[model samples]
Structures are given as C-alpha cells and as structure tokens.
Target: MAEDRKAIVPVWTLATGDVRAPALAGGEPMTAERLAELRGVLAVMADVPIATLEAHPLPDKLDRSRGIPLDAASPLAQHLSQFITQSTRSSLTAARATAMGENLYRMVVPAKVAAQFDKGFICSMAAKGTVGGIRGPLVTSTGRIAAGATFVPVGKAAAAGAAGGAGATAGVAAAGSAALTVAAPLVLMAVAVGVSAHADNKRQQAIEHITELLEQLHEQKLEEEHSALDGCRDAIDKATAILLDQGKLGVSLGLDSAVHAINTALGAADRRLARWQTALDKLPDDKPVEIGTLTKSFPGVDEHGGTFRAHLELAALAIALKRRVVVLQAVDHAQSDPGNPFENFTRALRRDQQRLDELESGIAGVLVRLSALELARQDGLMPVFTAGEVDRLMRAAHRIRRLGDGVTVNGRTTDVAIEIARNKDGSVVVFPALPMGA
Candidate 1:
C-alpha cells in the first residue's frame, strides 16, 4: 500500500508565470500558497474576475502524469505544431533583429556615448523596429490552424441512415429510421430490377437535402451582410437628413456642421458594400457546395445533431458580418462627427477615426473567439493517429533534419513535418504539421 501510494502520479500540471502547480505534490499535494501565487499572476495577465483568493506554496518536482506540458498526444499538435514552430521562428527573427540593432549602434556611435550606452541597447531597439514591422499579420498567419481532412465514425453513419429513414416517415429532426433500414436491404434483394432505381432515388434525395441546406446557409449569410449594410446606410441617411434640415434652419442651429466629412465617410461605406454586393452577385448560384459533398457521400450522416454545419455557417456569417461592418464603421464615423463644415471637419474626422479605431480593437477579439470556436469543431472531425505512428514518423524525420530532403509518404509528396523534440520538462513530444497542400 505504501509503495502504491508513493508511485501514484498526478493527472496534470498548470503553469502560472514562473510557478507550476502539479496535480500532486509529493504525497502532501499542492498547497494554498502556490495556488494563490498562480491565481495572482493569471489574474493580472488574463484580467479574470475571481472571488477573494489566498496564496499557496510551490511544489519542487512534478509527477510525469501531471507534467508542465499537457496533451503531448493531442491531434492539435499534430496539425498545428509547424505553424507554432513558424511563429516561434518569427519571434526569434525579431529577437535577432533587436540584437543586431544594438550591434549597429555600437558600430556607429562615438566612444563617449557608447561608454554610457547599455549593452545591446541600440541593437535591441533596431530589432524591435524590424520585429514590429512584421509582427501582427505574420503572427496571425502563423497561428492559422486548419484541419486537412474529415472523418466520420461508422456507428454515426449507421445511426444517420436509420434516423434519415425514420425522419422521412415522421418528419422530425430526431426521428428514428428503423423502418427504412428494415425495408432497404430486403427491398433491394427481392427485385434486382428495382435496385438501381431505389439507389438512384436515395442518392438524389440525399444530394437535394444537402444542397438545399447549403443554399439556405449561403442565403442567410447574404441576408445578414445586407442587413448590416442597410443599417449603415440608414444611419448615414438620418445624419444627412439632420444636417440638411439644420442647414435650412441656419448656422445658429449647427445643422450643416460636421456634414461633409460625415457624408464622405458614408460615401466610402456605400461604395465598399456596393462593390461587395456586385462581387457576390457574380458568383454562380449553381457552384458546387462543400458540406453538400460530405453529406452526399454519407446521407443523413450528421454528427453532433448537425452541429458541425451550424458552427461553420456561423463562422461564414460572422465573416460576412465583418465585411459589412467596414461600411458600418464609415456610417458610425459620419454620424458621430462633431465638426463644423466651414472648419475643414478636423474634430469630427478625428472623433470618427477614434471610433473606427475602437471598432478595430473589438474586431480582433471577435475574430479570435470565432476562430477558437471553429477550431473546437475540429476535434469532432479529425482522426487522431496512434502514438506509435506519430513516434515512428517523428523518429524517421529527425534523422533528416536541416537536410532539405523531400519527404514522400506512399509516393505522394508530403508537406507535413514530424517534430520529435524535448519539451520544457525533458519529455519527448511528436508535433505533426498539416499536409503540404493543407
């Protein structure tokens, strides 16, 4: 019993700044002081609201199960590790730039100024400038995680077939398809002549239903985008009406004030949306749909109660909303402007610009949250390779590191990379990259 107790491992470890809280700390376990310290750091960094919390003591060595880096076997690492590595590389490059800047300063500056200068100070500033220039969009691109393939479980496909048959009879989302299953195989065997007919009908029905839903989603996105555009236009129009009415009322009423800048911004919004609408109109309505093919391949085979499409549709809709939001921003600027028309509209333009800036700040947060949501759906869709398979790939690739040798799997050029490296805690992790085309 004592041996077993001593051998027990923790399930996980949470890192907070410099401190780590293991699930188990010896046999004594984690203390309050350590937890409090972790919570304090997290509170400051994340700005999380917490109840009155206390501090905790730290643990020395953490258990293997409760290690610093969790989920060493995650598929996310398999598909996204390279992107993370790329991001890390970008950071390193920026750091190098900073280091280089200080070197340049030392090279250029006089000795008297140089003697007083901090080590690597000039290099650091130059590196910062270089890094800052490439930071934002580069980071975002590096963080762009995507799933390369989709898989459906056998049981789910069967269930979908059964449910689809039942739904035809019952007209309900969760209806059972026992009747169809019972009749389907038997009906085909009884008459070979009707087999092709039955299969064709089934295939057509499946395709129709899938395509119909796809069209519906597309239309919904369009409507939402249009609604945002319309709202922006309405706001601008109202502000314009106010300005014109006041202009008639005279300069004393300040009606014509802030009018031109507001109108100019409104005009920009209208033009942008008009261009978007025209582009959308050009896309053929009969174009092939994505989810439809997935559905057609396995009719009525929706996992998570069709939640997958719902999530994807929401992402599409959100992007569309954001596109329209650019126009909405112009509307906001015009409506919120407070400058007089005769004064060259500086104050109003500045105020509108500030509002635009605030809108941009909020947009990034919204996009990140939306992306996270989209990524969360991946767990349900992607197949996870076995640990042995991951290990084999990683070890095989490790021998060829920095060799620039092309890796081919099953004779196809593979863009994916296998990372076999020690993590912070000295444990080996296998990080796989998305397929090359991916």
Candidate 2:
C-alpha cells in the first residue's frame, strides 16, 4: 500500500500555481514535456500575491482539508509547497465520481429495465392472443399500429395444425382435434411465461451484483485511499514543520533534508490518486468497470448487455473526468494570485472541457437508444418498451449526466460541466466522497 502511493506522482510537478489534485498524480509523470510548464509556474509565482487558508468556507473540492505551508519561506521551499498544497486536495472526487456510476446503475437502471421487461412481456402475450390481441389492436410500436402494417394472426402459425384438424369428419378424430385446438394457445403461453421468467431472474441478479459493487467501492477502495492520503500528509507535515520552525537558517542548514522529505510526500500522494491503474492503484476510475464491477456477477449483462455496459463506462469516465476539472478549477480558485497566472491551466481546462463535450454527446446518443429500445425486436416475444419505461431510462441517464457537470456556482461555466449536486439534496444523492483523514 505504501509503495502504491509513491508511484502516481511525477518527480517534477507544478502548473503555474494552478495544479489540479489528480493532475499531480497519474499513471506517469509528463516530466519531459512539463519542464517548461514548471519553470513558468516559478515565474508566475514571483509576480502573483499568494495567501494561505488552512480551512476554506466552501466545501473542499475533494473533501480533504489542507495544512497550510509556512507563509514565509525560502524560494525553493515556497515553490515546493505548491505541490504540497495541491496534494492536500484529496481522493474524494475520485470516490464520488465512481460512486455516481455504480449507484446509478444499481439503484436506477436495473429496476427501470426490469419494469420495462414486465410490461413488454404482457404486451407480447396480448399480441399472441394467449391473452386477446383483438381486445384492442396490441400496438408494440408507438401510437396505434400504422395504417398499412402487415398483421399476422396472433398464434396462427404455431396453432395452424390444431385449428385445421377441427374439421375432421370421424367422430373420435374430430373430438381429439377439437381438444388440441383448445389447448394450443395455453401451451404456447406457458412457454413464453417461462422465457420471461428466466429473463427477469437475470435482471434481479444484475441488481444484486450492482449493489455489491457499490458496497466494495466504498468499504475497500475509499477506505484505502483515505489511509494512504493521510500517510502523504504526515510526511509533508513533518518536513514543512521543520522548514517553518527553522525559517531561513534551516534552509541554509538542512535544506536538502527538508526537500527530500517533501519529495517523498509528493510521490506518495501521487500514487494514492492514480485511479486508472489496474493493479495497485488505490483511487477509482473507469478502467475497473471492464476488469471488475461492470462485468462481475451480472450474468448475461457483460455478454448480452453491450449497450448497457458501454453507456455505463462512458458515464463513469465522463463524470470522473469532469471531477478532475473541478478539482483543478478549485485549485486555481484557491490561489489568490492577481490577474491571470495560469494560461496553461486554462488551456488544460479548455481541453478537458472539449473532451467532456465529446463524452456528453455519446451520453445523449445512448439515452435516445434506450428511450426507443424494443425488447420485441431483440427477443421477438417481448413488446416495445412503454412510454413510461423510456422515460425512466431517460431520467437515469440524465442524472448521471448531472454528475458529469459537478457543482458550478458560477452561471458562466454552465457549458463546462453537467449539474452534479443541487443545493440541499446533495448529501442524499452523492455518496460520501472521502473519509475523515483524506
């Protein structure tokens, strides 16, 4: 676990005093490309006036509170402290982004999908006349059956022989044929009921699977992340305390030691937040959906539910990416620097915002697909989803879309994200993003 935390941070980390929490930690350091960016931060810091806030009035973006670096410092110590400050913003964003998907899929999608299944199965029976198709035209598609649509007699193909034999002349033969004709529709209905039952069972299993996934994400990964983040803070606090107490003389004396301890702290924090790593990564992200939650214990969901898995993966990734931007935005907001100190940060934000635009497009497309989905087309026996079913699915996707937005107090940045938590209902909707220490 300790080693896991060390690998996520790039050795060289800084971004014009606008460093994002996740950006400081990732799969690998962009040291080669970001050298110039680091130098730029140093230049900007000189010109910008900075302030320290041990606690902010606003909700901490990742829900981790930061310990301020000593206000007065050596230039080297001062510059390095920026890394500590960003690291202080923790893994709550990752946890929240992850929970948004798991909970939405668990609590929302399965129930809605199952309800559609029940309605479609009923429609199928009516269309087959096991229940009466002629009671009223059993229209599977929207409105009533289209004007010239071809009609197949509900159970005609399957029951043809039995119905035809009813005209037999011999007394015994006629009696038997009449009985077969009477029993045919009943037999067919029994079969459809069995198939529908089997499908419903799978849906139930999927809901259970999703529930377990949500539980593990909170109980395991979230817990581990908080513990690891605390480790990072402890390392930084020890080193910074020395720098704070000794002041200029300490930098002149034990400067190298302080720098080394700070570096150790940064490395740990980075690894702790590498949500994308498959093996030892403590944080949460989309890659795990393929490897774990989305695929696990969902029966045919992974195999037959291609569209289901795809939308979920996209939703989870998109929301996490948005949270990443919000964390960066929060960091940028934290710096009390005058004028614009972060052209690079703003450019990064713009790039992420554009990617989100692409993701949301994908999200919207699937929503349409879900809204129009016809189990009748997919399974032949079930009918088209009812309007209510479509609405339910659409509502789930829309809520997931909101998580991608994150909370934006400023009206101007509306285009930047989906609306995450609204004013008071946030706690009810958003799962706890971090534990106490993180």
Candidate 3:
C-alpha cells in the first residue's frame, strides 16, 4: 500500500513558494479576471503602488496614496477610489493568507508526506475509487455520504482527529467565485502555529485527522475522494486499526516533524508578516527605526546625542505621517461596490471603518509632535522630506498650532492610537496613543 502511494501522488513541493495546486480538469485554468486579481494581490504584497484604474492593465492595484491617481477628471477615478480601497484590503488579506500558506507549505508538509497520502489516495480511488480521508484534506468532507448528506457551502467542521501537517495551506473559501471554474472540486484551509503566522491544532492536526478518519469508517460517511483512502474505519474503525496494527501508513509518517514545521515556519513567517503589517494595515515604514537599541519609539535620552537624535527621528516621522495623510484622504474619497452584492465591499468597509474624526485625530495628534522636528532641522544636512512633502507637512502643521486645541486622554481609555514615521535607513519611529507637542 505504501509503495502504491509513491506512484499515485505527484512529486509536488512548495519550498519555492510557487504552488501549482493539483490539476482540476480544465487544467488549473487562470481566467483573465482571476489572473488580474492574482496580479493585483501580488502587487499589494510587493508594496507596488497602484498605477492605473484602466481595465487595460488587468487587476486594479492598491494605491498607497489612496487618493486620485491619473487625471481626477476621469469618471472612473471618482468611482474607483472606493473600489480601490476595498480591493486593496481584500487583496491584502488574501496576500497574507497566501504568504502564510506558502510558508507552511515550504516548512511543514514535505513533498514526500504529501505524495504519500495523495499517492495512496490516488491508488485507492483508482482501485476502490475513494479516500476515507487524507491529512491536509484537513478539510471535513463537505457533507455526509448518506442520501441526505448536508453541509453548508462554507463548511465549518474540522475533519475528526489526525492532525499532522502544521505548515499546510488551507483555503478561506474559493476566490469569491471566479468566472472560470476548475473541473475537480477543490478546497483550501490554513493554520497558524506558535508565532500565529495562526497555528490551529489540537491533538496535533494529525491527531485530529486520525480521529476523523476513524469516525468516517464507523458511524461517519467518507467523501467520494476519502472512501478509497486506506479503508472504512472497520466498516467503522478499520482504518485506525490498520494505521496502528497493520502499519500501512508509509515510512516514518513523521508526526513529530509536523509540529516542528509549524513552530519554525510560524516564527519565520511572523517576522515576514510583521513587515507586511507595518507597511499595509498600519503606517508604512519608509525606513527601519535604528536608534541604537532603542525601541521603535525613541525613548529617553541616554546621556549623548540628545537634540541630534530628536532632529533626525522627528523629521523621518513627520515625512511618514504626511504620506499617511495623503493616503487616508484618498480612502476618504473612495466609493464602495454598490453593484455587486457578492463582493460585499460596501458592507465590509462600513462594518470595519473607524469614525473619520477618530481616524484623523490620530493623524492630527502626530502632526503636532512632528512639528517639533521642523524646528530641530539643521541647515543643508539633506532634508528628510521632499519639497512637495514639506509644503504639505508645513500646511498641516499650521492647523495644529492654530485650530488644533490641546488633546486630552483619559488615563483609563484603551482605544488604540498609532503614529509612525520612517527614516531613510528604512528604520521607523512608531509611537502608539496620545502625545502631541510641536
């Protein structure tokens, strides 16, 4: 049986992060729309600025500016701001899922392990025509095998026991339905580990998977693909009996490796995901904040480099805040997808959006402290922000001194406040919560 598996499964591996999902009939078709969406999602992850709204370029890119891109006169520009922001966030979420999926694919599920089950599954399907269950199918079969087997389109149950592969990629539902459909049905799921890059496991996924396979053979019904896998749990517990008794499972079956892969991959992915979070969800990092061991926020002066440290840090932060404002403004003007109820862009943004005043209040507070950096500027030292940026920051600074009344924070409030500025070194100054001083 183990030998049969080697030949049944393909020699696919995700170490390179390039995954060609198992071929569904139409040969894993990439429709123009899906391809475009994929490109836009990729661009968001790469930090590529959104360049155009014209369908000619394919997927709509996420613009950091969040404001107008080409001539504002174009009707689409006005209509597109909302679409851009919605797409921006959606693409980002998808990108994050993909990164995490790819990372785990590379670190956890070995090509051999995956091949073993797939191979076994293939052989079973060929001979008996089913898989009672497989590891990362981690997916609960959509429904039971009975005449009235029922399951929600989006299944919520995890397959019983047997939780092995930790870094395996899982799906978050299909890409909101693509115009092009693949032949064989497909499902994807993801899990985070120690660092949460979300290590969701109990009894290890292996334990969980094994448990499910056990159930399927007994009182449970197996998926069409799952039934042929090894065998029915005894007609009830047969597969489990075989797993331990007959030792039909391949080689070492390395249950321990799955846990290790989840841990290591999560740590690595945590760092990578942090970078993405800083640039996307939060303020962008123009540079890394490297003030000789100081936290992201430059703390108390440690004897030396007082004013000079303040000068550089403040300038960088000021530039970043200004850039943030520009993007926020774009988001403000952007519209929602009113036509497509399926996209749910409008409801999503409305549900998640912070009040405009509250959002701006964060910017406003940072603008005030950032003003001090302008005063610290030394002559001819190569200014941090550009001329155009300076003009915007300068104007924004005026509102702080005049119209900006002092902001007061209630000591008990836990509402999050964030302000970030970046230096050319790619280091950043991130200060969360209230504190305004120009």
Candidate 4:
C-alpha cells in the first residue's frame, strides 16, 4: 500500500518568487503532459534518501553562540580566530587533495586562464552562498517513504502532487516554507566555510608551486655555471699547451741563441775593422797604394774576411780622399754587414725575434679571450668563473714562458742572453748576459 501511494517530490527553482509544487493525484484532473513535466523535474533530483519532517530531527533552537565575535578583544581578532578554528576543523586529507589539485592546475593552466578561474570560482562560491541562504534546502518530504526516495523543493512536491490528481494542502506548504527559511542561513554558512577552505588551499598551492619553480631555476643556473667553468678550464689548457710548445722552441733557438750569434759576429767584425784601420794608417796619404799588398795572405784570414777587405779598400780610397771616409766605413761596418759573420747572425736574429713576437702575440690573444670571458661573467652574460679556476689559468700562463727552464737544448742552457761590447783596445768582447734581478 505504501508503494501504491503516488510519491510527491519537490523542485526548488532559482527564478525569482516562484516557490510552488505541482498537484498530483486528485487535484484539478492532471494532464499527461503536466505529469510528464513533473517526472522530468524529479528525474534531475539527486538519488538519495528523502528526508521527512517527522523522520529527521530538527534543532529546537538556533545556536547563536556559533555566530561571529569569537573573541571579546577585537572584532578583527574574533574574525581571524573563527576562520582559523574552521580551517583546523576541516578534513586534512581533503585539504591536501585540494592543494594538489590547485598545484596541478597552476602548472598546466596559463596565468590568465588560472586568474580567470580564480575569479569565477570566487563568484560561484558567493552565488552559491547567497542562493543557499535565500532558498534553504532544495527538497523536503512529509509521509511514509521508501528508503532512497529522492526529495526535491517543497514547492515542486506540492506542484507535482497537484499535477498527479492530488489536492495541495496549504498548511503543509506553509510549514515547508517556514522550515526552509530557518535552514537557509545555515546552509549558506556551510557553503561559505567550504569555499574559504578551498581558497586557502589554492593560495598555499600557488606558494608551493612558485617555490618549486625557483628551486629548479637555481639548479639550472648551477649547471650552467659548472659548464662555463669547464669551458674556461679547457680553453686555458689548450692555450697553455700552445705557449709551452712555442716556449720550448724559443728557449732552444730564440732570443738566447740569436743574441749569442749576433754578439759573436760583432766581435769578429770589430777585429777585422781594427786590422783595416791599421793597414789604412800604414798607407801614404798622397800615393796610390798597390791593392795586391792588401790582398796578400794574412793571419786569421777566413771566408768572413770579405768585409775586412772591403773596409781595407775603402780605407785606401780614404787615404787618397784625405781620410774623409775613415769613420764612415768603420761605423757602417759596425752597425751591419751583408757577409757571413753578421749576415747569418742578422737573419737568425730576425727570425728568432719574429718568432718571439709571434709567440707573444699568441699569448696576448689567449689573454684577451680570457679577459673577455671574465667580462662576460661580470656582465651576467655567462656563468661566473671560480677563483680557483682563474688562479690556475694564471699560473699556467706564468709557467708557459718558463717551459724549458732547467732543460738543456742543443748543449746549451736555454736561459741565457748574449752581451756584446768593445774593450779599451777597440776589440769586441761577447759574453752571456746575466738574468735580470738574479
């Protein structure tokens, strides 16, 4: 019999001032169309146990203690304390789940979309709270009902009953209205609490996401720094190797040997020039001297003696020219020579000097590149160079020039400079120059 009784369901409409249920079973004869509409409305209701006024216990009086001003000190403090209490009372697992959802949303959503979602969510919460406060519970029932019977708005139930051929009761409708008015504010309060919790969780998730991104960026920067450092070290090693190899060559055949050969040539030139000067002094000032006597075999004569013969001929012409060319030829012979003694020495000296210049230029180029790297680091264009790496590069550069030190090359110590000078007798002396600040 209970199942035979046509069930009356309620539908709560949000449209303004429309809170009535259709009649069912014995009201102004219900039409098939109206019944179908009523059924359609009920079809959307949540599938749950219908709560009746008699079956469910209602609070005797509203608890005003739960309403605002949690503390007597200050209104602000009271509000904050109530908020904190409510947040603490929320399910921790739910809050964590919500936080994870928010974090995921932030990671995937564009900033503009996320911001819009936040605004829309807040507006939705506000609307829900307002609607819950005004409309109360959407459904209520008043009769013996089966378990899991869905309920709808009181107005919808009455309208449905009327549509189903039932006469609507004014007393029941009034009671339902009163019950909804009382329940509305409480429902709205619950909604507000849930929304507030969601908002707080979203804010925390945003903070966590920002922190995660910052940490990732820091790690990336550290990796870049290490890469730049490795690059700098590799560059330094390559540059150092080049300088070391060049330095070995320099120590072997560079400044030291070139200077020694030049000095030796200068000494021989000085001796020949001295002999020519003596021969010129023996020639009569007014007579043409026989060139054969000057060409005759002389002690210490060699292939390199051509300069001496040229100087002698020049000196003889000087005797005829009244000693005018004496100092000219002597100075010219001292400065340079195209013969064996000085020519080979000049060529070797130039070659070594050019090599030294090239090596110095290469070293300078390496330093320029290094300096540019440092500048880039300083300007934040590249990763910073560590102090240890910089110091190591500097040390390597310093050692480059000294690569052949303590190592003999071609039976001679590579760390020597040749010195050339004239004695009081106009004879040239050549010796190794001492190292500076030795």
lDDT values of the candidates? 0.24, 0.25, 0.23, 0.25
lDDT by residue (254-321, candidate 1, tens digit) is: 32332333333334444433443353344345542232332332232233223233332232232222
Q: Per-candidate TM vs. native?
A: 0.18, 0.22, 0.17, 0.18
Worst ten in a row by lDDT for model 1: 151-160
Best by TM-score: 2
- Model 1 Cα displacement at 61 (Å)? 73
- Per-residue alpha-carbon lDDT of model 4 for 1-438, expressed as tens digits? 133134322222211112333333222323323433433342233121111111111112322221211122222222222222232233242233223111100001112212211221221111122432211110111122322233232322211111111111111233322111111111111222222223332223323433433343444533332232223322322322232111222243233333333234334434545554465456565543322343342221122223322332222221211111111122123223312211222233333233323322332333232222211112234477689646644543343323222222112111111122212222222111211111
Runs with alpha carbons beyond 4 Å of true place in candidate 4? 1-119, 122-182, 218-438
CA lDDT of 413 in candidate 3? 21
> Tens digit of lDDT per residue, candidate 2, span 1-438?
011212121121211222212122122333322422422333333221111101101222321111121222322222222222332333332223233221110001111112211221111211222432321111212212122222111110111112221111111112211111112111111112222222222223333443444444444543343333223333333433442222222234433443344234333423322321222223233322222332222222323233333224323332332332232332233222322323322333444344334433444443333332222111234477677655644554444343333221211210000001111212211111110100
Predicted structure 4: lDDT? 0.25
The deviation in Å at residue 177 for candidate 4 is: 7.4
